[model samples]
Structures are given as structure tokens and as C-alpha cells.
Target: MQKMPQWADVVLIPLISLILAALLSALVILAIGENPWAALKLMVEGSLGSTYAWGYTLYYTTNFIFTGLAVAIAIHARLFNIGGEGQAMLGGLGVALIALFIPWPHWSLALLGGAVGAALFGAAWALIPAWLQAKRGSHIVITTIMFNFIAAALLNYLLIGALKPSGSMEPATGRFPEATHLPTFQDMFSTAETALFRGAPVNVSFFVALLACVAVWALIWRTRLGYEIRAFGQSESAAKYAGISPTRIIVVTMLMSGGLAGMMAINNVMGEAERLVLNAVEGAGFIGIAVALMGRSHPFGVLLAALLFGFLYQGGAELALWTSIPRELIVVIQALVILFTGALDNMVRMPLEAMFLRLRPAPKPARKTEPAE
Candidate 1:
């Protein structure tokens, strides 16, 4: 009954789009007077060359997974939660407060506390926008975007006046207690007498991101609340007729989205930086939008999309470092990928549908035996 095979829609389309993007990127490299093949070889060597590179790639991938899931879940509710940046900022505040004030005896306990604090703060930041949209009919996108700026300003004021440590000129808080330090991939692998992930920021939080992907998948596909959320997203009037409350779904969805975004701080702040700093998010929030879009809002799709962006991030840094290519070209490459995957998706999709249609066998005429019978 489908015009195109399911595999084509899910896998083939994305693969082809990626290939197109890569070809364009290669052309761009050639225009810059560099060998495209050599540039790509450098990217692969730098990003996947060794355990050290994998460490950074996975580290960045961990953050993307969290934020991408945040956007994906919200998309399921037909809500565009652009406030991930703001919610993540507030989550860092929560992590800082917990890691600084609480006397956790071990990193494990600190991680638990930090996750709770991050989720709570992230959800709290999203609450106002949810209420505004649910109760006052305000647009979620506008309200959430506005909240991002508000969050940044609020964080700035707090850091300068209250959070900043004495004798420190920076706007960041003091380092967390040593007990709060999360184990790096290096720390875990070194005990085996084999060095892997040495000097990389990838940490236990990568596993946490994986767990989150599994959890989100279960929540979306195997739960009654998820059914209602999807129903509400598909048709608000139909959901209302079925007695599902729009306000409730909207608020709950946003909270979950915000909570996921907030958890990114645990990886970057507690796991990697060991201290709360300004711009800890580093634009991962916006990148989540593209990830969610390209992944079709599926958890598994989001994971793969996150890894792809992670590769771009790590590889782009390497390109800038070793080649004459301006770092801005990397941004252009990313934009091209986003454009093909998200905005211009129909450009590829329509042709594929037509081809599939043409490839199908024609219907057979009725047999003459029917008339004889």
C-alpha cells in the first residue's frame, strides 16, 4: 500500500542525502585548492584514527544524544522546544549547586545528585513556557526562544554576583569537590593494563546517554501516556473528543524535553569540565533541532544522527587545525547536510517515489477462465 518501501524511506533516503552532502563538501574542498580525497582522509584519520579520537567523538556524541532526544520527544507532542539552550543553562546551575553544596562521599552518589538537580532545574525552567502555551494560547516556539535569552542573562547576573568564587576573575564557579569527579574512559580502561581513551573527555555519561535512548524509545512506543501524546499530536480535536487533556500533555511533554536537555550538563559540567562555566552548552541545543528533524523523531534515528554530528564536530576541528580550509566552511558543510535532510527532503523523496512506482509490475488483466467458469 505504500508508494515507497519502508527501508527506502528510513534508511536509503538518509544515506543518499548524506552522500550528496559529502560530494558537495568534497567539491567545496577542491574549490579551496585542497585535495578533497586528502581532506576526507584527514577527517577519518583524526576522528577515527585512535582510541584518543574516539574518546572525544564519543564525548561530543554523548551531549548530542541527550539534546537530540530532548528535541525528538517534544516533536512527538508537536511542540518545538527551542528553549533547550536556556533549560540546559539552568540545569548547569542546578548541577553546580548540588556538586558544590552536597558532600557526596563518591562520584557515583554525586552523579545521582547531579542528574536529579539537572532534571529538576531543567523541568522548572520549561514550566513557565508550558503554562503560557497551554493556558494562555501563547506560541511555544516564541515563548521558549525568549526564555533562552532570559536564562542567559539570569545566569550571567548570578555568576557575577553570587556564584563566582572569591579572587577568581572568571564568571564560572569554583571547581567541584574531588569526590564529584566522574570516571573518564581512560580511567576505566587503564586498570586493565591496556591504555584506551587516554586523555579524552569521554566518560561514563556516554553510557547514560545510551540508556536514555533506550528509555525514550520505551516511553514513546510502549506507554499509555505516549499513546495519548501521539494522539494529541496527530489531532488535537480528535484527542479532545477522546477526553485527553491538551494542557496536561503539553505541560508533561515539555517537562520531559527540558529534563533531557538539562541532563547534558551532567556530561559537560560534572563529567568533563569539573566546573560550571559559561556557554557550557556550546550550541548543542540548536543542533538538536536538526538531529531530531533528520532522525524522523525516532530514538534510534536520533542516536545515529547524534553520532554523525559528533563526527562533524571532531573532524571539523581537525580540518581547521591541519588544513588551510577555513573553519567557516565546516559550518557550511553542516548547513548543507541539514538543508538536504530537513528542508529539501522532498527533493529526494519525490523522485524516489516516482521511481518505485515505475518499477512496480503492471496489473494483469482478468483471466479468460473466469468467463468459461
Candidate 2:
């Protein structure tokens, strides 16, 4: 009776999209006089061959997870949050300030403080746009994007001025103190016989990202406020008739979305970079939009999508290093994936739905009319 099953919607469509993208990408490589099969093998080996590779892949995945959740939560509220870049920038600033000013006795305490600071600053940055959209009828997308540029300019000024260490020429804050340095995967998994995740930057923050996945899942599907959010998203007019305040939902949802985006700094700043740098967010915010879209805005889907993207990123880098394929080609491949998964989603879904409908068993015929029995 259903057009298609839930599993098909969540898993099959994405799988088909990936295949289509891969087929197109293979043609592109063949046109360039390269072997597509070899390239695929190389990518697999580079991204999954060893713990060292997995370390980098998972690190990127962690960033995507946080940002994807940000976008997903906003989508559920029918709000488009395009300011994750700015909010994450502010989050990095928060992390830098806390790391530099507070002399924590341990990394654990610093991490807790950094998370709070990052979330607060990120939420504060989103507050203006949320207010404008909720109260003044301004568009959330426009306001949030404008805020990104503002955040960038503000970060530039600080890095070149107050936040910069004395006599450092780089446009980045000085190294974080020793106590604030997070433990890497190598430290956690290595033994005297083997050095796993050697030279990899992945750290404790990856677990934090997983925890965030759980939390977002709970917030979106397990709570009362989540129901209200879904209701508002499904039909704003109906929600108003049902007494759900549009202004409150908009403000609260944006705040939560921004907070999730900002928390990404806990990985890149507190965990990987160990210092606040210019452009530390590195376009992870925008990638999150694609991630959320490809994931259908569900937390578990986001995790899987993030892992796929992480593989692409790490694999693409390997291609550039080991093959004649240009890094721009990798970008094109990633774009193809995004294009198919997002803009062309209906192209895949419609066919699958039709196929499922055909495969469904025909219903039994009604019994012939009989006298009341």
C-alpha cells in the first residue's frame, strides 16, 4: 500500500545515487585517458587500508557529523541556516579564548569549558538572525550568510591584533598550552609493538561527535519540543492554528542549530589544530548542507553520509598524490555526488518507487456479494 519502504528510502536511494555518480566519474576519468577501475582501487586502499588512513577519514567525518546535525535540526524546523560558517568561526574564537586564558589543570576540564564557550558564542552569533527572522520578518538565509562575512572579518582582525602572539608573523593564535592538548588516537591505541594512527590528528573529539549524533537523534525524535518542531515544519499555518508560536520555534531552533555547528570547533580547534587559525572552519559548514541533504536530515543517515564524504576527501587526496588525476577532478567528483544526491534526488526516487510498486503483490479480489451471513 505504501509507495516504497522506509529502508529503501533511507538506504537504497543513496546507494543508487553513489553508483550513478561513480559511473559518471569513471567516464570522466576515461576521457582523461586514465583507468577508472584502478583509480577506484587506489581510493579504497588509500582511505581504508590502515589505521593511519582511518584516523584522517574519521577526523573529517567528525567535523561533518557536527555540522550535518546543525543543518538537519534546522531543516526539521523548516529553517534554512546558512551561517554555520560564521557560527563555527565564533566557536573557534571561543575555544581560543578559553584555551589561552584559562589555565586548566587537565585537558578534560578545558574540554568542558571549551564546549560551553563554543556553544554560547555560536548561539550568540545566531541570535541576531534568529531575532530578525522571528520578529522583523527578515529571511534567515540572508541574515545568516551576512553574519558569516562579519565573523570572518572579526576573526581576521583579532588574529592580526589582540589574539596574535607577540612577534608571530602567522595569522593564527599561538600554540595552545600543554595542558590543553588532547590525546590523539595513537596515544589511546598504540602499544610497544605497534604504533596505530601514527602521525594522524584524530583525537577524543571523534567520540564527542558520536555522542552528538545520539543527542540530536534524541532531540529530533524522542522529545516534546521535537514534536513541536516537526509539526511546525510540516505546516506552519496549521501549527499556528494549533497554538505553536512561530517566533519561539524559529528562535529556539536556530539557537540549537547554531550551537551544534559551533561545537565542531571542539574537534578542529581543541583536538586537531591545537591553535585557532584563520579559516579554521575550512568550508565544513557548507559541506554540511550537502551532508544533511544527502542524509535526508536524519542523524543516523547523517553519520553514514559523513563517513562517505570523509572517504571521498581522504581518497581524493590520495589520488592527487599518487595519480595523474588533478585535485580539481576530485572536486568535480564530489560535486557530481552532491548534484545527484540533492538536486536530482527525485530522478532516482521516482524510479525506485515505481519499481517497488510493480514488485508489490496484487491485492486479493473481494468475495462475491452474498446474502447476509
Candidate 3:
């Protein structure tokens, strides 16, 4: 009964969409008086040519994985938790507090502690919005959006007033204890003279992101709660009739979403900066929307989409550095990808669906006379 195979729906559609986006992007570059092919070469060379480049690409990909999973989880429950930006900010605050005050004997323990703190803080940020949506019928999108600004302001106040290290003007916490310093790729892969990651910021957090992808997959496809969440999402009325609680599903799904979003801080703050700073989330929260859309809200899809965006990010930086293209153009290119993949998805999908339907063989007519003979 399906017009397209499941493989085609999941893989072919996105692949074609990306190809179209790329062709259009190339035209745009040519129209702007730049060499599109050259730009492409530079992007590949810069983002994937060397271990150094892969380090940066993977580092960005790690952040995207966390945020993408966060968005995807809420999306599965038919909820739009746009407050990832704010939740991540609060998660950083939690990380800062733990890393600065607690003297963990080792980075492993510190990492565990940081994960707990980040998850709790992120979940807390989403709690009120989820409650309001479930209990008061408030719009989750508006409430979560408002919370982003509130989180920014709250972080600004705390960093400027209470948490700022004395005699330091920087609006960030002090460097974390040495014991909490994570092992970098350079340390893991190189000697004193030779280096793999070199100056790149990729760290153990990348592994954490990978593990999270697996965890999310299991949660979505292998767990009872996940079934209830998906059932509620598919039809609230039907789920209610089946004895599933809508309010409970909404609150729990948002909590998991926010927790995933918050854990992103462990990568940027603990693994990279070794300190909490303002704007550390760096719009990864918003980019996650596009990632989730392109991935169709599946964990495996999210991982691939996250890597693609990560390539765009790291490669775009290289493009800006080496070509006449303005840095803003990189953002424009990213937007176009998001446009074709997310907003304009049906533009590509509908045609493909029609073609596939037509390709399906027509049902043969019955031969009644021949059958009787």
C-alpha cells in the first residue's frame, strides 16, 4: 500500500533534497561572481582533508548531536521545545558551579557529575513550560521562546554579580580544576612531537555524543515509555482511551529533550573551554531544528544531518577564510540547505511520491471468461 519504500522515504528523499540544494547553492555562488567549484574544493579540503580538519568538524558535530537529539525527542512527542538555547545556558551554569566548587578526584568523575548537573538544570528549565502547556493550555512554542531570553538575562546577571571571579572582568567562571581537564584527541592520539588533533578542540565529549545517539535510539524504539510517548503523539485522544496520560507524556518527553540539550554544555564548556562563558550555546539550539527536520526526528537520521551541518559549519569557515565569499554567505548557504530540507521539503517530496506511485504497476484486470474455461 505504500507509495514509496521505507528506505526511499528515509534515505532517497533527503539525498535528492540535498542534491537540489547543492545545485541551487552552486548557481547562487556563480551569480555572486565566485567560482562555485573552487569554493567546493576548499570546503572539502578544509573540513575533511586532514586530521586537524576532522577534529574541528567532529567537535561541531558533537554539539549538533546533543542539540539535535534534544529537538528530535520533543518532536516525536509532537512538542516544539524551542527553549534548548536557554536550557543549554542554564546547563552551562550548572556545569560551572560543579566544576568550580567540587574537587572531583578525576575527570571521569567530574564528567559524570557534570552530566547529572547539566541534565537536571536543562530538565528544570523545560519543567515550567511543559507544566503550563499541560495544565494551563499555554502555547509551548511561545513559552519556550520567552524562556530563552530569560535564561540569557539570568546568566548575564549571575556571571556579572555572584559568580564572577574577583578582580577578573571576564563574564565567565574561572578555569576548572586541572583534575577536571578532559583528555583531548591530541593527548589520546599523539606523542610530544607529533599531533593528530593538534590545536583542534575535539575531545572525549564526541564519544559521549555518539553514546547518546545509541541511547536515544533504544529509548525511542525499544522502551515502553517510548511507545506511550509515540502513541500519545500520534493521537492524544486515542492514547487517552488506551489509558495513557497526556500530561505525563508531555512533561516527561520535554524533560528528556531538555536534558539532552543541556548535556551539550559538557562538550563545549568542560571539554573545550574548561570554563563557562556567555553565548556558549552559539545558536546550536536553533540549528537543531533544521537538523531534526532533515533527519525526520529519528536518532540515526539526526546523526547524519548533524554531521552534514557540521561540515557546512567547518567548511564554511574555511570558505570565508580563503575565498572572496563573505562570511555571511556561509549562513545564507546553510539557510538554503535548511530551506530545501525542512521548509520546502514537500517541494521535492511530492514530485518524488507521484513518480514512485506512477512507477508502481497497475493492477491486472480479471479475465472471467478464461477463468471459467
TM-score: which candidate is best?
3
Candidate 2 lDDT tens digits, 126-205: 99999999999999999999999999999999999999999999999999999999899999999999999998888998
Predict model 1's lDDT versus the native.
Answer: 0.90
Misplaced by over 4 Å in model 1 are 362-373
Task: Provide the RMSD of all predictions against the true structure, rounded to 1 decimal.
Answer: 1.8, 2.0, 1.7
Ranking of all predicted structures according to TM-score, beginning with the best and ending with the worst: 3, 1, 2
| Per-residue lDDT over 92-185 for candidate 3, one digit per residue giving the tens place of the 0 to 100 score | 8888899999989999999999988998999999999999999999999999999999999999999888888999999988889999988889
* Candidate 1 similarity to native, TM-score: 0.95
Question: Could you tell me which 10 consecutive residues in candidate 3 have the lowest summed lDDT?
Answer: 361-370
- TM-score to true structure, per model: 0.95, 0.94, 0.95
lDDT score at residue 228, model 1, on the 0-100 scale:
90
